[model samples]
Target: MTDNENLKTTPLDSLHRELGGKMVPFAGYAMPVQYPAGILKEHAQTRTQAGLFDVSHMGQARLTGADPATAFETLVPGDIAGLGAGRMRYTMFTNEAGGILDDLMATNMGDHLFLVVNAACKEADFAHIESGLGDRARLEILTDRALLALQGPAAATVLARFAFAAATMPFMSAAEMDIGGISCLVTRSGYTGEDGYEISIPAAEAEKIARLLLAEVEVAPVGLGARDSLRLEAGLCLYGSDIDTQTTPVEAGLTWAIGKRRREEGGFPGADVIIGQIRGGVSRKRVGILPEGRAPARAHTEITDADGSVIGEVTSGGFGPTIERPIAMGYVAVGSSLPGTRVNLVVRGKALPGAVVRMPFVEQRYYRG
Candidate 1:
């Protein structure tokens, strides 16, 4: 058997198979890449209704100490200390050179901090946190948990029937709750641009909760393929694809994540370099692209100027199910990052007309209250 054949399986592996899911290797785990409904339908379903995703492969960890906020601030640039209890903040794990190691979500669960990181980079993220915080904080990896995301315009309505507490939770907030008598940590946040919630429950109870959520008329099981296209349409970055260790937050258009206090206080790793970029600007920036033809521009496709000179490359590209056209995102020179700047995408050795456009080819439907 290949090394990937020996990959781990989530608690819902058998359930996925029972649902006619097509399984594939992802982040050292065998996960459902798509269901029989296919990526196109699944993508549209999520935009119109609710879609349930098994994101248990993600890493969940906790940091505890006399003052966990102080320990966390040493590594990340987010305003953790100012974040109220039961609130979540999106932040980045930055290197000393201002490059991003990973992008993650941090939630204050009153006594300790709850963190969810990318599945592929969990080991590096954990080691980095441990070495930086050391004796000041204790790191606990919760490998026994399973994560599920219910996302769409009707997500809140569907989840409201199962858990009353979820109905009251505000955006970017979280709380400990029981779903069908199983204890779980529920957060009003997700990777999709739409308003959604991520529920972290016991591994053994994962299937039960998933089945319950799927039982709802508006909910369907969506897989990785649709998940990627949905996030791309929302203009969210995919780790390793859109942003990586070589990309800085400023270059990725995530400068708003660095709070004013954190930027001026200058205590976190990479503060100098990142702050410098905030003032001096970076060489290139991540922008959205609208291709001319119906043919989708896949990743690594060359981006060129009006005169057909190579300027940059596409990082994430595909057919947008919602827009019904080809769209993409990539890093281009700072001077060519304007919304109306004309550009060309070299596809099959031909330069196709394109233009720099505002991101989120589809409008975001986040529930803000």
Candidate 2:
């Protein structure tokens, strides 16, 4: 639905163009899909070294109230009340039908809950949140901020220069710190399933911070292409692609995001159906698919059994530069969702041999330490 003719640009837009970024329309923004180094090199670099991503298009906001957690938990089925200060949790805003409106990260910043939602759904998401919790909470959209993600194995090493304790910060934790002399909120989490930081700084200083991060020996400026590949290899679901209004957390392999308290209290929207699914299970589930040979299976590719019966369809698929092979994830009937289950991905006209495999085709290098 994004119109290519008139798309919003991020703080790093000019810088990205200067670096030879292949500009494209993404989530209504003029974003970079790749640089001259290409998607393959960017993917490999991020897996082995570090890659910087401009993610300012993502929605950032703060919820402040007498009890922000309780107010926010009305829409999301997560234990917001149980989150400790400076901790973060991945949760989804579920609709009354037990479907996801949007998936987001909520950080308990002591005084309030800091939330970041998907770029494509921000306007609708904020409106939904505001209409529901307006009386109980004050929503302040951080429009002046720019978000940057520094991800990969070498991420912490590069960021530690500005904030030494960054190397020690546990995954899914956030802190207000100064990076390269700029005041920012740094979260020791990212989409790539690696040790990293998502920094939120003033929009005016975004390009400056990005340049500083890229100046590091191990860091390279990556684009949306590598970001998608990295997250796909991590087995993370894409907002509209793998999950959406029709998909529930249980169906999308995100049951872990629904906390015990929320599940037991049953106050959130769609609790009736979601809780039922938690107890009874779903008919189909999101699973990993590994295609044999060099041909990469793409999104919407039909997943079929050996007998040519359609089982599911590919959601996100691409070649993982780090794994050096084609990897994909899609929804399949529960009977065929188990790892090692033989399957076929109908690519173009041929049924390519594949298997329902365990997710994170590339090992998660998260720093639990």
What is each predicted model's overall lDDT from 0 to 1? Answer: 0.92, 0.93
lDDT of 1 by residue, 23-126 (tens): 99999998998999999999888999999999999999999989998789989989999899999999989999888999999999989999999999999999
Per-residue lDDT, model 2, residue 261, is: 83
Query: Model 2 off-target regions past 4 Å?
Result: 1-5
State in Å the error of residue 328, model 2.
1.0
TM-score of each: 0.98, 0.98
What value does the lDDT take at residue 55 in candidate 1? Answer: 97
